[model samples]
Target: MARQGRHGATRRQPKGVAFDRWLDRVVTVAVLTAMVIGLTAVAAHWLL
Candidate 1:
């Protein structure tokens, strides 16, 4: 197998790390918020 250069690995022809990090944070925050909301709903259902 041929090894690719760091830049070659990027799907975007001209790539920067800032986009990837921002995307990761956004996804993480969204998933966590969803989980919290789900748990809250379940708790309210059982407790109320």
Candidate 2:
């Protein structure tokens, strides 16, 4: 077995945390929007 230290642990950002949260939301929305658009396009192609 091996021992883990602080150097090998994940570190949290201590600055601009609010901006990071906002960016995460924006990215999630963008990804969902793209998925919807792609599915709509495929459905339209098959139906028409």
Q: What is the TM-score of each candidate against the true structure?
A: 0.67, 0.70
Model 1 poorest 10 in a row by lDDT: 7-16
lDDT of each: 0.89, 0.94
Q: Model 1, stretches more than 4 Å misplaced? A: 1-14
- Considering every candidate listed, which one attains the maximal TM-score? 2
Model 2: how far is 35 from its true place, Å?
0.5
Which parts of model 2 have CA positions greater than 4 angstroms off? 1-13
Candidate 2 has its poorest 10 consecutive residues by lDDT at 5-14
What's each prediction's clash count? 0, 0
Report model 2's TM-score to 2 decimal places. 0.70
Candidate 2 lDDT (Cα, whole model)? 0.94
Error of 1 at 13 (Å): 12
In model 2, state the lDDT of residue 45.
100
lDDT of 1 at 5: 68
